[model samples]
Target chain A: MLEYIGKRIWQTLIVLFLVSIIVFVMVNVNGDPVQSLLPPDAEPWAVEELRTSLGLDKPLYVQYFMFVKNALQGDMGISYYQQTPALNLVLDRLPKTVELALAAILISIIIAIPAGAYAAVKPESPFSKFIMFGSLAGISLPTFLSGILLILIFAVTFSWLPSSGRGDAAQFLGMKSSLFTLDGWKHIIMPAATLGLYMVAMLIRLVRAGMMEVLKQDYISFAKAKGMPGRIIYIRHALKNTMIPVITVIGLQLGRLIGFSMITETIFAWPGMGKLILDSINRLDRPVIMSYILVVAVIFAFINLTVDLLYYFFDPRIELN
Target chain B: MQKEKILEVNNLKTYFYTREGVVKSVNGVSFEVNKGEILGIVGESGAGKSVTGFSLLRLIEEPGEIVSGEVKFKGQDLLKMSEKEMNKIRGNKISMIFQDPMTSLNPVLTVGRQITEVLIFHQNYSRKDARRRAVELLEMVGISSPEKRIDHYPSQLSGGMRQRVVIAIALASNPEILIADEPTTALDVTIQAQIIGLMKNLIDKFNTSMIIISHDLALISEIADKIMVMYAGDIIEYGDKGKLISEPAHPYTQGLIDSLPVLERDQKRLNQIKGLMPSPLDLPEGCKFKPRCDYAGDDCPEGTELFEVSKAHFATCRKAQFFSKKLMRGVG
Candidate 1:
C-alpha cells in the first residue's frame, strides 16, 4: 500500500511539474514584461535599475531557475505593475475563487444525482424524457452565456440584489457580515447559480448516463429478482457503482470550475482571482499575473489530489492499489 | 392444482416499440411453476425467454410494456400491482440471478457488502446482522476464506466465486422465488457444473422455487424437473425434462434436441435446424415456426393451438398429433 501511494505521489509530481512548464511558457508568449511595465520617459539608469532589481537582466534560463526556486520558497517575487509582492496580491484574492468553486460543486452535485437517477429509473417515462431532453439545453448553453442571461434577469431587470462586488458596507471577514452572511448569499446567489447551474446540467447528464449503465448491471437485476424495493435497488446498489466514474468527471470538472470562474467573476465584478488576473493583465503586472496563474493552477492540482483520494472510497480496488 | 401453483403466468404478451415498429417479444405465453420446483425455460436468443423473466419481476421499464397478461404469484396478480407496491415485493420475495457473473455483480462493492446490502434493506436486518449473515452466505455458496473474501471486490474473485456471491446475495433474504437467468453461461464448463450442483443443493435446503432461464438445453436438462421450450415468445413444448429430452413431441423441440452434440451416440450425426428464427416484427404468417419446420404442411401452418401429446407433454405442432410416433426416435 505504501509503495502504491508513493508511486501515485511520484506521478502526481510529474504532472504538476509538466503543468508548471506549460504555464511558464504560455505566460511569457505575449512578449517582454519590461515593455509593459515602463511608462513614456524612463531614463536608461532607471531601466537598468528596474531590470537589475526585478532579475530580468539575467539570462532567460537563469530567470526561469530563479522563478522556480522563489516559487518553491513561497515567494512569488514583486508585481511589475502594482509594485507589490505577487504572492500576497494573489493570496488576498484566493478565498473568493475557492468559495465560488466550492459552492458551484456543492450545488451541481445536489441537482445532478437525483435528476439523473430518476431519469434512468423510469427510462422513457414522460418525467424521464423531461429530465433527459431538458438537460440537453443545460449542456448546449455555455456557462458564460448563462451567466449573462442571469445577470440580466436578477441584476439588471429585477435590481433586487447587488449586480457586482463580493459584498457591501456590512461587516464580515474584511467586509460587512451581510455581504458574507445570510443576505450576502443573496448577492452571491445569482453569480454562483449562473456558474453552478450549467455545471449541474453537465453533471446531471453524466450521472444519468452512468446510472443508465449501472441499472442494467447484474447486481441491480439481482436486487430486483430478490424482491428488493426499487428505491433500495437504485440507491444502494446502482447509484453507488455509478458514482465511481461520475466522481472522476467531477474531479476533472473542479479544475475546470476554477478556469470557468475566472470569466464569470470578472463579468460579475466579484473580488476573486478572475478579476485579479484581468487587472494584472491590464496593468501588465508580470509578477502578480504569473503568481495568480500559479495559485489557480495549484488550487486545481489540490482539488484533483483530494479527488484522487476520493477514488479509494468509490472503488475499493483503488484503495487497495 | 391451485395450491400447487406458486406462480402462474397466463396469456402474457410483452412488446417493445422502436422507430421501425412494435416487436412482439413475448406473445401468448403461459406456464405455471409448482412449489419448490426448478422450472427450466429454454430457447435460442431473441426467443423472449429473458423478457419473460423480466416481465414476471416487473423489471421492464419503458420502450417495452406488458401489452396484456396476468402474472399471478401466490394467487396475487403481480401485473395489476402499482409500481410502488411491486417495489416492495421485488427484492424481498423474489430474487433474480443473471448470466455473466462479472457483469452482474457490482465491481465497486465487496461481495460481503453486496449480499449484506440486500439483507439490510429487505430482511430488515441490522448492519451487524447483515454482515454476519453475509459471511454465512459466502461459506454456504462454497467460497473458501469467505470471511476475508467478503471484504474483497467482485473483481478479486474468480468467475465461479462471483457467481457464488451472486447466488449468496439472491438467497440473502430467503426469497421464495429465485430467477437464475443463465447464471452459468459465462462460466467455464467445470465451474458451470459446480454452480449448478451448488444451486441444486441450496434449492433443496431452502425449499425455494426457481425459474432457471437459459438457451443451453444440456445445462437445464441436468437440473430442471419440468422444462419448457420457447420459440418466438411462445412456449412450443412443455413436459418432464426426461420425457422432453428423450421424446420431444414438437418439431422445434425435435430440432433443438437433434442439434445438441451427444457423446458416443452412433445412430446419427447432430442435426442443425434449418432457417433462422424470424425477426419478431416480421414473424411468418400461419405458424410462427412454419418457415423452419421440416414437418410443416398446409394444415401444419394452420395448427396454432397447443395439443396434448402425452400424459405430461404438450406441443404446438400439428405433426405431433398426426405423426407423433415418427418424430419420437429423432428426439429420444
Candidate 2:
C-alpha cells in the first residue's frame, strides 16, 4: 500500500509540473504584465523599475525557471492586487470552496444513489421516468441559470431563503461555516443546490446504468435463488457493486465541482476561491491566477490518488500492486 | 420403491414478453424429484433447460414471467406463497448453484462471508458459529486449507475452487432441494470431472434432492438416475437413465446418443441432428421438434404429449415405435 501511495505521489509531482508550465504560459500570454500593472500615464522609467522588480525584465526561460523554483517551494510570488503571498491568498479561500463542494457532493450522493437505484429497479415506472427526465433537465441547464432560477423561486417568490451572501456563519473544524446556523444554511442552500444539481444529474445516470448492469449479473440471480430478501439483495449485493463505478465518477467530479463553482459563487456572491480566481482574471493578477490554477491541479491529482485508494478498499480484485 | 417427493412442478410456463413476441422459454414443463435423487436435464443451447431451473426458484427477471405454474415443495404450493414466505423456503429449504462459478459468487465478498450469510439468514446461527460452520462447509466441498481459503475473495481462487465455494454456500442451510444449473460448464475439462465428483459426494452425504441441468449427455449419465432430454421449450424424452441412453425412443434423443463417439466403433464422423430447433417465437404449427427430427413424418402432430414408448419410459415422438424396432434390429 505504501509503495502504491509512493508511486501515486511521484505521478502527482509530474502532473503538477506540467500544470505549472501550462498555467504560467497561459497567464503570460494575455498582453504584458508591465502594462497591466502600471497606469497609462506612468513614466517609462517607473514601469521599467516595476518590471525589473518583478523579474519580468529577465529572459523568458530564466523567469520561468525562477517561477518554477519558487512554486516548487510553495511560493508563487505576491498577488499583484493584494500585495500578499499569492499562495496564502489562495489557501485562505480554499476552505469555503471545499465546504461548498463537499456539501454539494453530500447532497448529490444522498439524492442520486436512492433515486438511481429506484430508477434501475423499475426502469419503466412513472416515478422512475420523472427522476430520469428531471436529471436530464438538470444536466442540460447551466449552473448559473439554475442558480438564478433557484433564487427566483425560493428567495424572490417565496422569501423562504436568502438570495445571496454568506449569512451568520460559525466555525467548523477551523473553517468558517454556515452549517451550524439556520440563516447560514438558508443562504447556502441555493448555491449548493445549483452546483449539486449538475452532480446529481450526472451521478443518477451513472449509478442507474451501473445498477442496471449489476442487477443482471449472475451473482444477483444467485443471491435471489438463495432467497435473500429483495432489499438485502438490492443494497448489499447490487448496490455495493454498483457503487464501484459511481465512486470513481464522484471522485473525478469533485475536482470539477471545485473548478466549476465560479459561476454559482459569482451569482450567490459566496466568498470562495472560484470567485477569487474570477476577480484575479479580470484584473490580470498573474500570480493569483497562476497559483489558483496550480492549486486546483494539485487538488485534482490528490482526488485521483484518493479515488484509486478507494477502489482498492471497495474491491478485493483491485490489488495495490 | 416410492421415494418421498421433495419437489413437483405442474405445467410450468415461463415466457418472455419480448418486442417481437412471446418467447415461451419453458412451455408447460412438468417434472418431479424425490428425496436423494439426482435428476439430470439435458438439452442443446437455448433448449430452455436453464430457464426451467430458474423458474423453479422464481428467479426469472424482467421481460420474463411465470405465467402459470405450480411448484410444490414438500406439498406446499411455492407459487402461491408470499414473498416473505418464499424467502423462508429459499436458501433454507431450496437453494441453487448457477453456471459459471467465475461469475456466480460475488467478487468482492470473501468465500467464508458468502456462506456464513446464508447460514446466518436461514439458520439463525450467530456470526461466530456461522463462521465456524462456513469453514466446515468449505472443507466439506473438498476445498483444502479451509481456514486460509475462507478469507480469500472469489477472484483469488481458481475456477474450480470458486465453484466449491458456491457449492458450500448453497449447502450452508442444508437445503432440502439443490438446483445445480450447468455447475461444471465453466470449469476446465479435467476440473469438470472433479466438480461433478464433489457434487455427487456432497449430494449423497446430505441426501439432498438435486436437479442437475446440463447439455452433455455423457456427463449427465454419470450420476443421474433419471434423465430428461429437452428440445426447444419441451421435454421430448424422459425415463430411467440406463433405458433412455440405451433405447432413446425420440429421434432427437437418438441423434444425441449417436453423436457421442464410441471407443469400439471407428466411424469417420459422429452423427448429428440435421437442423436447429425452431425459434420459440416462430414455432411451426405441428411438432416443435419435427423441423430437426430426421424421423419426422409428414403427418407429425402438433403439441404431441408424452406417450409411453416402453414401461415407465415416455417420448413425445409419434414414430417412436418404428425407431424402437429399427434400433433393436441394428443392435442385434
Candidate 3:
C-alpha cells in the first residue's frame, strides 16, 4: 500500500509538471500582458521600459525557466495589474470558493444518491419517472442560464433573497463564508443550487445506472435468497456495491466543479477564486492567469489522487497496487 | 410408512413475457420432496430446471412471472403468502444455493460475514453467536481452518472453497428444505465429488430435505432419493431413484442414460439425442419431447401429461406403456 501510494504521488508530480509546462506555453502564446498594461497613448520607449522591468525582454525559454524556478520556491510572481503576489491573491479567495464548491457537492450528494436509488428500485414508477425527467431538464440547461433563471425566480419574482454578490455580512476566518450562519445559508442557496442542480443531474444518472446494474448481479440474488431484509439488501448489499463507480464519477467531477464555478461566481458576483480568475483574464493579468491555471491543474491532480485512494475503502476487489 | 412431505408443487408455471412471445420456462411442473430426502432435478441446458428452483423461492425477476402455482411447504401454501410472510420462511425454513459458486457469494464480503448475515437475519443470532455459528457452518461444509477462512473474501478463495462457503451460508440457519441449483456444475470433477459428499453429509446431519438440480444424471443419482427429468420446461419423468435409472420410462430419459459413457466398454461414438430442445416460444402442438424422441410416431398421443408406469414411476410419453414389452431387453 505504501509503495502504491508513493507511485501515485510520483505520478501526480509528473502530471503537475506537464500541466505547468502547458500553462506556461498557453499563457505566453496569447501575446504579452505587459503590452496591455501600458496606456493606449503611451510612448513606445515607456512600454519597453515597463517590459524590461518586468523581465519580459528576456528570451521565452529563459522566462519559462525563471517562472518555473520561482514557482518551485512558492513564488507565483506578482500580478502586473494588482501589484500583489499572484499566489496570495488566488489563495485569499480560495476559502470562499472551497466553501461554495463543498456546499454544492454536499447538496448534490444529499439529493442524488437516495433519489437515484429509489428511482433504480422503481424504474417504471411515476415518482422515478419524474426524477428521471427532472434530472434530464437539469442537465439540458446551461449553468449560466440556470443561475439567471434561479435569480429571476427567487430574487426578482419572489423577492425572497439577494440576487447577486456574497451576502453583506462579516467575515468568518478571513473569508466571507455562510457555512455556519443561517444568513449565509440564505445567501448560498442560489449559487449552490445553480451549481448543484447540474451536478445532481449527472450524479443521479450515474448512481441510478450503477444501482440498477449492481442490483442485477448474482450476489444480489444470493442476498435475496438469504432472506436479507429489504433495507439491508438495498443499502448494504446493493447500494454499497454500487458506490465504487459513483465515487469515481464524483471525484472526477469535483475538480470540474472547482474550475467551472467561474460562471456561477460571475453570475452571482461571489467573492471567490473563480471570480478573481475571471477578472484577471479580462484584464489579461498574465502572472495571475498563469498561477490560476497551475493552481487549478494541481487541484485537479490532487482530487484524482484522493479519489484513487478512496477506491481502496469502497471496493475490496481492488488491490492497492 | 411414507415420510411426511416437506415441499409440494402443483402445476407451477413460470413464463417470461418477452417481446417476441411468452417463453414457457417452467410449464406445469409438479413434484414433491419428502422429509430428509434429496430430490434431484436433471435436464439439459434450457430445460427449465433452474427456473423451477427459482420459482420455488419466488425469485423470478421482471419479464418473468409465476403465472399460476401452488407451492406448499410443510402443508402451508407458500404461493398464497405475502412477500413479508415469505421472507420469514425463505432463509429460516427454505434456503437455496446456486450454480457458479465463484459469482454466487458476494465478492466484497468475507465468507464468514456472509454466513453470519444469514444466521443473524433468519435465526436472530447475535453478532457474537452468529460468528461462532458461521465458523461451525464453514466447518460443516469441510472448509479448513474456519476461523481464519472466515475473514477471507470470496475472490480470495478457490472455486471449490467458495462453493463450500455458499453451502455454509445456505445451511447457516439449518433450513429444513435446501434447494441446490446445479451447485457443483462450476467445479472440477474431483471438487464436484467432494462438494456433493459434503452436501449429502450436511443434509444428513441436519435432516434437511433437499432438491439438487443438475444436468448430470450420474451426479444426481448419487445423492437423490427420487429423480426428476425435465424437458423444455416440463417434468417428463419422475420416480424413485433406483427404478427410474434402471428402467427410464420416457425416451428422453433413456437417451440421457444411454449417452452416459461407460468405463469398461469402448464404443465408436457416444449415443446422443439428435436435436436441441425446441424453443419454448414455438413449442409443438403435442408433446415437447416428441420431435426429439426416437420412438416418436404418428400414433404418439397428443396429450403428454405424466402416465403412471408402475407403483411409483411416471413418464410423459405415449410409448411408455409398450416399452416394457418391446424395449425391456435394453435395461441392464
Candidate 4:
C-alpha cells in the first residue's frame, strides 16, 4: 500500500509539472500582461521598463524556464495588479474556497445519499417521485440562475437572510471561517446551496441507480433469505456496495465544485478564489492565473489519488496496485 | 415408517405481473417435505424450479408474488402469517442457499460476518459469541484454518470455498428446512461433487430437511429421498427417488434420465427433450409439456390431471397408465 501511494505521488508530480507548462503557455498566449499593467496613455519607455522588469521582454522559453525555476522554490512572482506574491494571493483565498467547497459537498452528501437510497428502495412512492422531480429541476437550472433565484426568494421576497457577501467570520485554526458562526452559516446557505444543487441532483441519480443495481445482486437476495432486517439489508449490504461508484463520482464532482464555483461565488460575493481568479483574468494577471491553475491541478491530482485509495476500502476485490 | 411432515404446500401459485402479461411461474404446485428428508425439485431453466423454492420461503420480489398458496410449516399456515412473524421462521427454522456462490456472498464482507449475522439475528448471540460460532460454521463446512479464513472476504476464496461459505451461512442457525436453489450449478464438476458431499453430510449431521433444486437429475438422485420433476410451472412427476428414476411415469422425467451420459453404454449422440419450454406468456391450451413430449398424440392436448401410479407416486401425463404397466412388467 505504501508503495502504491508512492507511485501515485510520483504520477501526481508529473501531472502538476504538465499543468504548470500548460498554464504558462496559455497565459502567455493571452497576450502580454504589460499591455494591461500600465495605462493605455502611458509613454513607450515606461511600457518597455515594465515589460523588461516583469521578464516579458525575455524569450518565451526563457520566461517559462524562469517560471518553473521560481515555482520550484515556492515563488510564483508578484501579481501585477495586487503587487503581492501571486502564490500568496491565491493561498490567502484558498481557505475560503475550500470552506465553501466543503460546505457544498457536505450539503450534497447529507441530502443525496439517504434520499437516493429511499428513492431506489421505494421507486414508485409519491415522496420518491417528488425527490426525482426536484432533482430534475435542480439539474436543469444553471448555477448563476439558481444563485439569483435563491437570493430572490430568501433574501428579496422573505428577507430571511443576507443576500450577498460572507458575514462576520471567526478565526479558527488561523483561518477566517464562516462555519463557526450562525450569521456566517446564514450568509453561506444560499451560496453553498447554489454551488451544491447540481451536485446533489447528479449524486442522487448516481446513488439511486447504483443502489438499485446492488439490490438486485445475489448477495442482497441471500441477505433477505437470511432474514436480515430490511434496514440492515438496505443500509449495510446495499448501501456499502453502492458507495464505490458514488465515492468516485463524489471525488470527481468535488474537484469540479472547487474549480468551477466562480459563478456562484460571483453572485453571492463569497470572497473566495473564484472571484479573485476572474478579476485576475480580466486584468491579465499572469502570476495569479498561473498559480491558481497549478493549485487547481494539484487539487485534482490529490482528489483522484484519494478516490483510488477509497476503492481499496470499498471493495476487497480491488488491489491497491 | 411414516415420516413426520415438516412442510406442506397446497395449490401454491406464484406469478409475475410483467409488462407483457402475468407469468404463472409456479402454477398451483402442491408437495410436502418430511423431517430429515431431502426433496429434490428438478427441471430445465425457466421451468419454475427456482421459483418454487423462492415461493416456499416467500422470497419472491417485485413484479412477482405468491398470489395464492397454503404453506404450512409445523401445522401453522406460513402464508397467513404476518411478514414480521415470517421473519422469525426464515433463517431460523428455515434458510436458503442461492445459485451462483460467487455472487451469493457479498464481496465486500468477510465470510465470517455473513455467517455471524444469521446467528446474531436469529440466535440472539452476542458479537463475540457469534464470531466464535461463525468460525465453527466455517470449519463445519470443510474450510481449513477457520480462525484465519473467517476474516477473509468472499473474493479471496475459490469458487468451491465461496460456496462452502454460502453453505455455512445457510446452516448457521441450524435451520430445520434448508432450501438450496441450484447450489452447485456455478461450480466446476469436481467442486460440485465436493459441495454436494458436504451438504449431504451437513444435513444428516444436523437432521435438516432439505429441498434441493437443480436441473441435474444425477446430482439430485444422489442426495434426494423424493424427486419432483417440473416442466413449465407444473410438477409433471413426483415419487420416491428409487422408483421415479427406475420407472419414470412422465416422458419428461424419462428424457431427463436418458440425457445423462453413461460411462459403460456407448451412444454417439445424447438424447435430448424435443422443443424448448413454451413461453410462460404463450402456454399451450392444455398440457404444458405436450409440444415437448415424444408420446404427444391426438388426445394429448387435453388438460390431463395427475394420475396415481403407486401409493405415493404421481405423474401428470396422459400415458401414465401405459408407463405404469410397462414398469410393472419390468418389475415382475
lDDT values for all models: 0.81, 0.88, 0.88, 0.90
Q: Write the per-residue lDDT of candidate 2 for residues A68-120, one digit (tens) a residue.
A: 99987989999988899999999998878887898899889999999999999
Every candidate's DockQ is 0.57, 0.79, 0.74, 0.83
Q: What TM-score goes with each of the models?
A: 0.88, 0.96, 0.96, 0.96
Predicted candidate 3 versus true structure: per-residue lDDT over A109-196, tens digit per residue: 9999999999999999999999999999999999999999999999999999888766545577775566877777788888989988
Model 2: docking quality category = medium
| Model 1 lDDT per residue over A150-239, tens place | 888877898877778775436555642333566667767777777777778887888888898888666666666666666777887889
- Residue A131, model 4: lDDT of 96
Q: After superposition, how far is residue B298 of candidate 2 from its true place, in Å?
A: 5.3
Give the Å error, residue A38, model 2: 3.2
Q: Model 1 segments beyond 4 Å from truth?
A: A12-38, A122-160, A167-180, A319-321, B1-3, B267-269, B298-301, B318-332
Summarize candidate 4's per-residue lDDT along B126-176 as a digit string, tens digits. 999999999888888999999999999988999999999988988888899
Q: Answer with 1 or 4, whichever has the higher lDDT.
A: 4
Model 2, B1-332: lDDT tens digits are 88899899999999999999999998888888999998999999999999999888887887999999899999999999898999898888988988999998988888887888888889899999999999899889889999999999999999999999988888889889889999999989999999999989888998998999999999999889999999888889988898898877888888788788888776788767787778789987657877776677766755568878787688887375567677645643
State, as a TM-score between 0 and 1, how close model 3 is to the true structure: 0.96
Relative to the unseen true structure, what is the C-alpha lDDT of residue B4 in candidate 1, on a scale of 0 to 100? 76
Evaluated against the true structure, the overall lDDT of model 4 is: 0.90
Q: Best candidate, lDDT-wise?
A: 4
